[model samples]
Target: MDTSLLFWNNIISTCGVPRIITSDRDPKFTSELWTNLYDMLGTKIPFSMAYHPQKDGLSERMIQTMGISLGDHLNKNLLSIHPTAKDVHDMWKKACEKDAKCIAEAKEYNKQRWDKSHKEPDSKEGDQVLVSILNFNNLKGPKKMRDSFLGHFTIIKLIGKNEVEVRLTKDFSRKHPVFPVILIKPYFQTEEYRFPSSKKNPTAPEIVEVEDSPGPVKRIIKASKIRLNGKDQRQYLVRFKNQTADKDKLLAEDAIPDANLHLRRFRASRRTE
Candidate 1:
């Protein structure tokens, strides 16, 4: 905390206190001390939403530009210090040659290590594959005990040579549809029984088909105010009848016409609280 305050104090001394700050939900930034300090300074701190960093895109791009500019400036300074242009050119050429050699050696080493444990995946567009669950935390139960892979989902298309895009369901909306070849494996169907059963089932349940409307709204779980197109709008986290909590969807207020009564009740309850 002291270190963070000292760093920010130095920045403030140099650039003056900023009117607004945008940051990710890092522990240091979210601490009560940090919040109180900013509150006292009358600076608004708008945190980027979880899993969304594009909110700070401008700052990130600026930092990247500064890094590139600084590197080029340093190189120019080094060239100026050298006795001759030829000497600088030769030094650059040698550096490039060494870099290329190191890169080639690294690639060969990685390839050999990969070959020891993995065969080159033969997946192609339209093939069904199971994706590794290693990167996702949405699954229920202990991580070690849970299934290591999910889906026989179809591949939508090849994304470059190393990654393939899969057609994922709504449950996986938070995750990118593209997965690396290393994290996916070919899915094969189980063989049918060779021997037939002697006895047949006495009863079979009749199947009923129901027309889909927006399924009945179970309840409005929560609400949040968001800015869209330079305007503020309220979005509700809604759970529909027969749907699990994990399947809850975020909908704009206007989209849930059928849930108006529930929305009203929710607002009334919030007011009381």
Candidate 2:
């Protein structure tokens, strides 16, 4: 699952990664080689990012398909699912392809929907959403983020597409609560919205409370940063305290006690004389 998803994400998201995505820092992304891979492409893999959100429908369908394909080969009790669980994956690919007619139909349906403003990403303030977090600690970045839902926060304001201002409270913050909108994933959460203490919210010029203002419909960005693990890191080359013609010369000199050796030779010559 990890290898396949990485395959899809890496292959599908190749446009210089300005719009980088992670299918949840699924253990596969954390592999040391992945850092070097994304770095070469010029984007930092999110250090404090959440896992890609899972869809129940997709998971259920995939599993059901797998079960049907493996049904005939099973020799276990009904409750145990693929006891080995370790599959060759080429087997999964073949199994998935067996439903050629159904797959073709699904593809055609998706093709018609492509570029047709499918569903808008997500909108409005105060909705609960899944935010992807990454394993920051390992990369000398944010703290260690385990694979889990970290918090349920509220969206306070929307900036241009790809960014938003959010508060991690029913009570909004005065300054630092504002974060970039990319980290938020809109779910069907409506209960978290809290009206500020001020009653004349609309009349206030401060714009502390976000209102559903109509405008040139723009994309929403999250107030908080998406956490991810890898950095577009580069190694620093070693330099000397004083400029030298040859670094290797200093290195070789350190290897043997040249002064001591020379002094011993001179003393032996003096004794012989």
Candidate 3:
């Protein structure tokens, strides 16, 4: 809150008080002190919806263009030269035009690339869809091995042109229910049997208690010290018995009590080297 107030004060000092203030639903922008100060100044504060940027698209684009122009100027060492007010204005005008043209071209290129693999979403309210897992972090297992999409969530309602309110499961309770159309895909049910003519009763495989009786450590590939929760801890890259190199896992020292013998052997071998 203090930083936001200080920033706004600096902006106001240089540009005078703005009649209207637009911001996102950030905690600092929505704080009581911020609201009270703006209210006293008679400046209307309009907040854009969460996770949506289209509301301030124009301003964002302009800022991006200006940043690109400034970066270009700096890279070319053009800022070192002194120029008249008119010269400065002309240079800025030209830079803005050039940046705008480049931005348009980039946008068109992205649209074409996106269109090749994606189509307009036709999902409606109550339709079951799979939400993209790109933004989620609470999921278990290795990221590369995890499913790219998760759900069977139903669309509750359409928020606007491209956003929708989804009825997500309790697992996603912490996440916002709303998401853009690009992050959702229609869910399709898998067929029980692709080849119906083949009459074969599939037998269920026996469930192994791998966690209860984990395989013995075949060898300790390597060891490393890492900082965990502000403390230094040792970890081992272990390959287990009967498992291939690909099945190797990184484990804390205490995680495999039986691996103490292996750990000692590894340390002794390293000392000899």
Candidate 4:
């Protein structure tokens, strides 16, 4: 290689000489000639950092990242060979074998994802689920599907096995009663297990992780527990407020008295965080 042009051209290509150059002290890197060239260019030479055993863990992780990237590249190139994948086992044994790393295998994997052939899961009565808004970009629907759940939305009616009637969230309307299963998703948490909040209190709710529904915007989250129903909302459900009281019943009603309960914002509704 013509050392002068090679060195000067690289310097020019980089816009200008950097104040410092950090390099790994490889044979080409640490050569006295390389050091002298940098000195002539008026750039401070910072030697390649020494590798530490603990820091080498990062290097190992980087190598793994590179391997995955290269694997993705090879799989993308392998697309043209997709049709021949199954035949790899019998025809082109070198190319067509089904493997986690094989192009043919990648095509098969992608096919399963895009294929409409698989049966859809049934949403039936008495099943728990999370709800998703099919299109909240609808001027008026529960705004956003309640909590991704909206819960144990018991199927009150069956549209089909894959489609069934579920209970409407209080946020929607009490009179609305039932909603279709298309609004719901399987209520599942990815976490392996949950922890009890207080070991001493067996009756206390377990401390568990639950996913948040995407709100109109990011929510300001807070760490707190809230009860869904109060005495008044319970009364609204039971219809005590709508009862016709007789003279005798009036006395009992006076004794009991009516207490109004407020239900406004939802529990952990919006989060600052």
| Per-residue lDDT of candidate 1, residues 148-250 (tens digit) | 8999789989977899999987788778899999899888775333234554566888899964645788889899999999999889998888978887888
Model 1 error, position 75 (Å): 34
Per-prediction TM-score = 0.31, 0.21, 0.32, 0.23
List lDDT for all candidates, in order. 0.80, 0.49, 0.81, 0.50
Model 3, residue 91: distance off in Å is 17
What are the runs in model 2 whose C-alpha is more than 4 Å off? 1-118, 135-145, 169-182, 187-273
How far does residue 71 in candidate 3 sit from its true spot (Å)?
27
How much does candidate 2 score in TM-score?
0.21
- Give the clashing pairs for model 4: 23-48, 88-96, 131-148, 219-271, 220-270, 220-271, 220-272, 221-271, 221-272
Candidate 4 lDDT over 122-222, as tens digits, reads 76657666555443232345654444444445566766555565676665544344444456666654333233453353477779996442222111112
Per-residue C-alpha lDDT of model 3 across residues 1-273, encoded as one tens digit per residue:
565477567876789776655566788778886777676677767676545656775665666689998887654445555435338788899999999999999999999999999787788888989999978978999889998899999999998779999998998888998998988888866543434676568899988875552477888989989999999999999988898888888889888657779888999989999
RMSD each, Å: 29.6, 34.3, 20.5, 24.8
Candidate 2, 138-183: lDDT as tens digits: 2233354355433466666777666666665433233355444555
Weakest lDDT window of 10 consecutive positions for candidate 3: 77-86
Error of 4 at 92 (Å): 35
